[model samples]
Target: MKLVNIHTLIFILLFIIIGLNTAQAQVWSLQQCIDTAQVHNKNLQMNRNNISIGEQKEKEAKANLIPKITVNADYKYFSNLPYQLMPLSTFNPTAPVGQYKEAQFGVPHNINANLQLSMSLYNPQVYGAIQTTKIASELTELQYLKTEEQIFFEISNLYYNAQILHNQLAFIDSNLINAERLLKNMQLLNEQLLAKGTDVSKVKLQIAQLTNQKESISSKYEQVLNALKFAMGVSIEQKTQIDPNIQFKRANEYTSSTILDIRIIKTQNRLLSSELSTLNKSRFFPSLNIIGIYGTTGFGYDKQPNDFLKFFPIGFAGIQLSYPLFNGTVTQRKINQKQFELQNSELQFGLLTEQNNMQVENAKLQRMVAKKAVETTTEQIELAKTIYEQTVLQQKQGTASLTDVLLADNALREAQQTYLSAVIDYLKADLELKKLTGNISTTK
Candidate 1:
């Protein structure tokens, strides 16, 4: 008896420990999940890399204005050739027409080395390059921001879908519990000769149906959980519960005046406009450059004592002017192409503005409709719950049939689920409004 009691105590303690551990697991909130996803997502990180590359391009644009310097060196050996020398009477006059004195003849070996520096004094190409790179950086930045927005959109939908599945599962669990209770009650009543065998079979069938419903909902819930984990970049081997506190805050709290406008894209378009203006200016302005070179070369015989003549440091400084004189009408065609592109961009921008307006209007209408749905569903749930409680109590008093009680229970569960769905829809619409208006905090 003592050993059996000790074993029972140990078993109870183990059960308690398991329950405590299960209860101690943490539940992640929606914002926390989104933050985790943004931190760990591979594609978002790649977009960030693209942004860094754009910054490097911006650095390159700045570097274009800096001067460039280079060094050059060469060596040569001549065994026998027409050596060069100063204007001296040549002893080899009879040997060749232009041959000089053997002593005055240039050296048979030569080496030349020099350093040269050049800076762009005035070059339209440089200006155009700078402007183009700046625009490219801005465009890349916009693309990164757009990528972030898209991730947020996808994550939000996945998170909400998981929540919806969770609620549906809760409904199924509740229904399953009710069905099991009804089956047990019918079984007991039949044993006491107060219920028919047919009643027991009917309750068993209800339990079976509820079991199938639970299984179906469980499958759907697993699918939704997997999708949510995927969006959050969580591993399949990991297990985590979601917090149900998404209902703690209303969408009104996240809404503000700043959350109602989409002006960033417009700002980018203006930058593009400035870029196009710079490109147009580039077409007419010719480039100006200053070129200067200093070097030394020699070919003489024992003239300067270094196996070569004196390193006559040659230097030339000059200004070069160049312009696109003509190119099969390409320049004019390019200008026309740019004009057409600008027109198309303007039209697209206008269309985007109109679309954004429609989105905002639609979102607002959806939120309003969803709000009404929540209100209506809330009232319906209250009425259904009242009816269910009354019907169940009447059944206990033998004043209502089992079917009436079951119908009332199902109706209440459906109304509750409908309310939850409406609430989720409202929240999603509110998020859409914020996203469309560029109001969501995207710093992460």
Candidate 2:
């Protein structure tokens, strides 16, 4: 029986050890998370497909200039041949003038077949459409990059939140350890009649509160981790941990470059400009094309002794030119509308540029303020810890009241919270600044 119990205990211990190791193995770096999301993200896949669609459209527009070939065939049979008018002077040279007779003109059965070919020599619309689609392709690529930047920003924020919660949980555990030690010290003093039972009760209450806080923070940490997993395009049930270590690096002053947003707007402006250009070209330029046809016509008549079949070859080619003489001013109206659109796009570009500039400056200032807070909070936490420790020693030596120890403990907890809050603020501001400056990337 003793041997069986030992074996069971050993198995339980080994199981727990293996579980911990497995969990640790699932830890993902920020780059790993981003790489997986880029590969599996649905939005990114759609944008990539959009780029392909744009390319095909560009090709389709160019195809409009290629020669188009077609074959046509027809067959017809008449029940009776109709009569035609003929002059009465056909038989005699000096017959009565203005006299006429009726005559039939064609065979009863006829067949015709033709092959037609047409190619555009110069078409303003087709050429303009090709240019438009090329611009649209560039626009689609920019949109994909914009989505990528957004995803990176989201994942970074979620990861930062999880790290903050993790550190908060660590702080709770640290407080719990201190509270448990205080409780033991108070209990010893109570046994010797040097401390009251109420003091011991107070320490126990603090411990209980710290334990509750730890539970709450742990739950929040799990929630944040789940959100991070979702942002990374992974299964919600998948077990993963972020890099627990959070570092705050003070960045030097810098101005933002041309971010994705600016480039996208500029691309949009170019597209609008191209639309206007196409409309103007269509209104002024005449379309020119070459058309050709080659075919044969067959006539067949079935009769007792006059049965006959005959086919004649036919071929023709021509150059065609078409200019819009008038169409109720429709093209002119469209041209006016397109010009208005171009003007609006120009205004929008200006607005976007100014807005981004404003945001960049504000983000820079916020990060600076948050960095100062982090420094201040760091020193405050050290001072609070020292105060709490000295008060505990004083209480053990009978120089400090129980109320003083509790107050010091409360101050220490407050300092810890303040420090964590400051660090989070700094991180969030720094992330925002990086986004504005277009510096956020896998390496940074």
Candidate 3:
């Protein structure tokens, strides 16, 4: 019974260890990586923060149209009372008209308190600002979309690179296995005096070279994996594996109108044109405001001579109107400046639209070429493998030289590398086409 209990504990421990490892091993698909990056990427988060700031600015602009109320208080101390001069003849009718009297009045302390309210009734600038802020908020949202598209492209590119590295490593591993087998056979032949020592040495050198290439590819694979993780906003300490299922196909065509960069510039141009219109309208319009105030004036005096404290209430309200008759043509100059800015934005929009069209065309051509290369390399790799196998058999039969086998091996490796490069190119070109069409934001 004791032995059985100990065995059961060991089994439970082993099961828990296996369970932990399985839980830690996670495979992330392309969609999963993009989604995670959208939420966690530092640059994307900063863009989101800009959106929040834009929203708050819009709220502030709207608040400017509402009434503003404030309460204020002030105190003053007078070491000597204020004096006033009066006509003395008013008190005594018989006195001369030039006679006057001087008197000291009021207390030595004073206080004032007030509550004021003011609101704009008709201010063109304020109204224009409200509209401008609304547009600015929209621009910020578009910027976030742009950032998302950029991050998606980066992640896709890195992920494609990692996949290419993985394929290369696999190729190297396969070649290493073949080279080791050939080296072992050569060693056997050399011992039996059937193969030259130089042939055995050459085979051994080939195996060593393949081993070095494998190690180098392994190191590169790890680097690419780390870069993929960084782009996905995943922790470097975590182990991650990408889903190896990738399909290559033709990308859909796109026009300049679908490009995000072009769209963004067009939106900005619209905003600038609106600003110019607002500035022109503001020059001819007037502003009106309503103001009101309610307050109390307090007076206090020391008891040594005259002990008295009094408070008097006051209130008033009125309307004010202001017009910019002329300010040395400042408004006109500002309007001119705004018009220039609008023109500049329009030019930028045009330039960007043309550039994007060029990019779309270029990417399409690249994708076509890569697709063809992939097909060609796939056939070449098969042919190379068959040639290598035949050459190895002929060498063993003493019909082919050792150099023939080496040449076949080199050709196979070259074909494999070409295929990997073609695949990477196709994936990247497809991603670029999607980006140009603004499909990256919606697609996985």
Candidate 4:
């Protein structure tokens, strides 16, 4: 008995310590999760890398104007010295007009080396490319911001879902407590001969059902939390919990202005226009480059007293102008294709504006309807709880049957479900509304 008592005491202490640790675990707020994801989410990090890559591309464009220097070298040796033909008249002043002598002209070894440079004096393509990359860099930043908004949207949705599950689990726990209390009361009445055994059985069945419901809800809650943790870019093993409080208020009408999508399209249009301008320039405006080179040619021979190695110096500077006289009309084809794309993009811009306006209106109406449902369901929950309590009291007083109490419990459960549905609808509609208005990026 002494040993059993010591073990029991240790078990109780361990349970208390575990409970304390769980109670102290950090509960992440919605804003906290969003902020953490901004730094850690894999998708967002990739977009940041793309932004850096775009900046490098802009720098590369500017580098086209800088002078380029290169060194070249070559060496060759002839196994059989190459022969050359000389006029026979050089030896015998009037030999035959058709006669000739063969001679070998230089050393068997040869080498050439040079350092050359070319700098652009005026280049339409380089200047035009610089302008295009500037706009492209802006597009890259907008793309990153677009990705950020998408992350915010996903994380917010997961958190809201977790909160809904949390509330449902809370409701199940409340129902379980009520069912257990009723079971105890029915058992007492059965023993005192005031209630039949079937009454006790009904309450037991109710308690079992509530227990099953609680287990299912708890499992769903755990799954939702796991999903939330993944969205936060934290380890699935992380002990993550969302704030149980879901804050919402009726939102006012959102005004429309320039949105990110339109801005991105506008930047794209500018880039296309700049490229077309470059293409047109290529057809007419010529490019000029300043060139400079300094090098030497070497000759080497090895045999007897006349063996020698010699180097000859060479240098020159000049300007080169290039003009594209013609192609198979390829540049014209590109300009035509680009022109069509620009027109389509402009049309898409207007189409998106109209679509966004329609969605904004729809979201506003949905939120208002859900807001009304939430208000109505809240009152229904209160009334249902009151009826449930009165029915329980009546059953205990012998004025109502066990079936009446069960009916009241079912009514209470239905009201609770209706309330949850309304709240979720309101939350989802509000999220959609914020997204449509382009305010999601600015959302906290």
User: Which numbered prediction scores highest in TM-score against the true structure?
Assistant: 3
Ranking by TM-score: 3, 4, 2, 1
Instruction: Put down candidate 4 lDDT per residue, 53-170, tens digits, no spaces.
Output: 9999999999999999999999999888889899999889979898899988889889999999999999899998999998899999998888888788888888888888888888
| Total clashing pairs in model 3 | 0
- TM-scores of the candidates are 0.79, 0.84, 0.92, 0.89
Better of 2 and 4 by TM-score: 4
Q: All candidates: CA RMSD in angstroms?
A: 6.2, 4.8, 2.7, 4.5
TM-score, model 2 to reference: 0.84
- The predicted structure with the larger TM-score, 1 or 3, is 3
Model with the higher lDDT, candidate 1 or 2:
2
Q: Write the residue-wise lDDT of candidate 3 on 133-191 in tens digits.
A: 88888888998988888888888888888778777877888998898898898889889
Worst 10 residues of 1 by lDDT: 253-262
Worst 10 residues of 3 by lDDT: 249-258
**How far off is residue 188 in model 3, in Å?**
0.8
Compared with the true structure, model 1 gives a TM-score of 0.79
Total clashing residue pairs per candidate?
Answer: 6, 0, 0, 0
Which lDDT tens digits does candidate 1 get at residues 1-444?
999999999999999999878865767777887788788877788888998998898788778678777888887766765645533334434464554443334457777877676777777767776776777777777777677777777877777777777777777777777777778877887898887898888777877887787788778867776777777777865676776545623446333333222344555566666666665666777777777778886545664545435567777777778777666877677767767777777777777778877887898889888988988998998899799888867876789888897789779888988888898899789778778766755422
2 against 4, candidate with superior lDDT:
4
User: How should the candidates be ordered by lDDT, best one leading?
Assistant: 4, 2, 3, 1
Poorly placed runs, candidate 1 (over 4 Å)? 1-24, 73-113, 248-268, 298-312, 442-444
lDDT of each: 0.74, 0.87, 0.85, 0.89
Q: List the residue pairs that clash in candidate 3.
A: none
Provide the lowest-lDDT 10-residue window in model 4. Answer: 250-259
